[model samples]
Target: EAGVAQSPRYKIIEKRQSVAFWCNPISGHATLYWYQQILGQGPKLLIQFQNNGVVDDSQLPKDRFSAERLKGVDSTLKIQPAKLEDSAVYLCASSLRQGQGFYEQYFGPGTRLTVT
Candidate 1:
């Protein structure tokens, strides 16, 4: 099976600028996720989608970040007026449901964003 995919592997922007990131999950996966990993910290769940519908986004900053997976296959995340603290590696992950449980998630290479 293929792994999750993300683009614009690296981005450099000044604070207050806007940037967007894209993700494509592996085939047959039923659940997708977006996470932000700051340097020296563990990855933080930003949003989760279950087949084109949102399943969780309690940690997403509504005023600065947004994401969507409307087609159930691909998704996008955007940050407007980004802050310096927002510099981090944005990761995309996907997982499959097994029997009545869930499989471990597969992660993409991630896009590294640096805000100056």
Candidate 2:
């Protein structure tokens, strides 16, 4: 009955500082995702993992951002030398099933990061 969970409910960092985030998806879920949401914009998918394997990450800022889902249960996202533009809410989500069919993706209480 549990859902996704993210750590450090909020974070504040200076420009060029590094930061890390953690997420735990619902049990039995097979797909996980990470997204970035700006103050006034819709969440943008950053990366996706399907059972310990990466499915998509073309939108991720490779130069400074990285994410991994180990053992297909827990996931972590990190940013190094973060830019001010990186200020946003980092959201973690998971779905019980994923594919061509429609399924619900549950989201966690996002990690709000502020860059100064």
Best by lDDT: 2
For model 1, give the 10-residue run with minimal summed lDDT: 94-103
Question: Which residue ranges in model 1 land beyond 4 Å of their true spot?
Answer: 98-101
What are the lDDT figures for the candidates, one per model?
Answer: 0.93, 0.94
Give me the displacement of residue 96 in model 1, in angstroms.
1.1
Candidate 2 — worst ten consecutive residues by lDDT sum?
96-105
What is the C-alpha lDDT profile of model 2 across 1-116, one tens digit per residue?
A: 98788998999999999999999999999999999999999999999999999988999999999998878899999999899999999999999766834878899999999999
- Please, what is the TM-score per model? 0.94, 0.96
Q: To one decimal, what is the Cα RMSD in angstroms of model 2 from the true structure?
A: 0.9
Which candidate comes out best when scored by TM-score?
A: 2
